[model samples]
Target chain A: AQTVTQSQPEMSVQEAETVTLSCTYDTSESDYYLFWYKQPPSRQMILVIRQEAYKQQNATENRFSVNFQKAAKSFSLKISDSQLGDAAMYFCAYRNSRTFGNKLVFGAGTILRVKS
Target chain B: NAGVTQTPKFRVLKTGQSMTLLCAQDMNHEYMYWYRQDPGMGLRLIHYSVGEGTTAKGEVPDGYNVSRLKKQNFLLGLESAAPSQTSVYFCASEGTGQETQYFGPGTRLLVL
Candidate 1:
């Protein structure tokens, strides 16, 4: 079984600043995928960024990037130039690529607050 | 196109009452999943379907039943509601060869 952990329950960042949310997971599978999802007050889940375990390079999507350390079993999400819209509950998820169902295992979550 | 939609955005039920939540997707996805979200718990998988008529239990399948008779539709049933079952339920679907799972708005259920 795979488990994802987000140590921080609440985080706050000033507008236009940068913020980093930490995440760690335990999995024995060599081939897997890591993802960051955002949920706003609207209650809609949105994909922020994703990283493949096999890829040594981190994944970057515009202002959102990920720091993936496979050896340490750590995957952290970084948001640059943070805005009010970035205030949401962020979740880290893991999925085994080799599995037939490809079910996602998610972390408890980190509540992000953007201060103006 | 409607990616994924869940019927009855909100509902309240008394203990021992039964109800079903419907989920539909228009992306021609091959997989569908049901999950429940609590205050501190991010989300727990309840049940999932690999294909039409093929359903499997997930991490938290107790007190929940699901049916995937049609490829695009998946229904989650609560045979006997309980206060513990009060939470937001979400439905997701993934297309073939895609790792991303599209989520629906979600259904908020409160069991009194």
Candidate 2:
């Protein structure tokens, strides 16, 4: 079984500043995928970013990027120039590549607060 | 397009009551899933269907039953509700397998 861990239960960042949310996972499989999802007060889960284990280069999506260290089983998300809208509960997820399973193993989640 | 939608945004059931939660998707996705989100426990899969007329148990399926009669609809039923089964239930659908899943707003259920 794969497990994702988000050590920080709460995090705060000043507006226009950068903040990194830590995420780590445990999986015996060599090939897999890592994802970060954000849930606002609306409780709608939205995919923020994803990283493929085979890719050595980190994935970047506009202001959202990940520091993926496969060897260390770490995949952290970095939000550059954070905004008020970025405030939400962030969850890290894990998936197996071959199974194509939609069943994502998620972390407990971290509440991100954006200060103006 | 509605993407994914779960009927009865909120529901309340008695300990021995039986009810069904409907999930409909318009994305033409072949795979659909049901998950329960509990506080501090993340989300756990209850059941999933790969295609129409096919359903399978997921991580947590002991108390729930699911049906995928049409390609666009998936239904989850609790034969007898319990307090422990109360939680926010979410429905998700993806393409063949490894694609990013699009989720529904979720249904908040309370059992007393």
Say which candidate scores most in lDDT: 1
Please provide, for model 2 over A47-101, each residue's C-alpha lDDT reduced to its tens digit, 9 standing for 90 to 100. Answer: 9998889999999999999999998999999999999999999999998887755
Model 2 misses residue A20 by how many Å? Answer: 0.7
- Angstrom error of the Cα, residue B3, model 2: value is 0.7
Residue-level error in angstroms, candidate 1, position B109: 0.4
**Tens-digit lDDT track for model 1 on B6-80?**
998999999999999999999999999999999998889999999999999999999999999999999999999
lDDT, candidates in the order shown: 0.95, 0.93
Per-residue lDDT of A1-116 in model 1, one digit per residue for the tens?
89999999999999999999999999999999999999999999999998989999999999999999999999999999999999999999999998666789999999999999
lDDT of 1 at A65: 97
lDDT of residue B40 for candidate 2: 88
Worst 10 residues of 2 chain A by lDDT: A94-103
TM value for model 1: 0.99
> TM-scores for all candidates?
0.99, 0.97
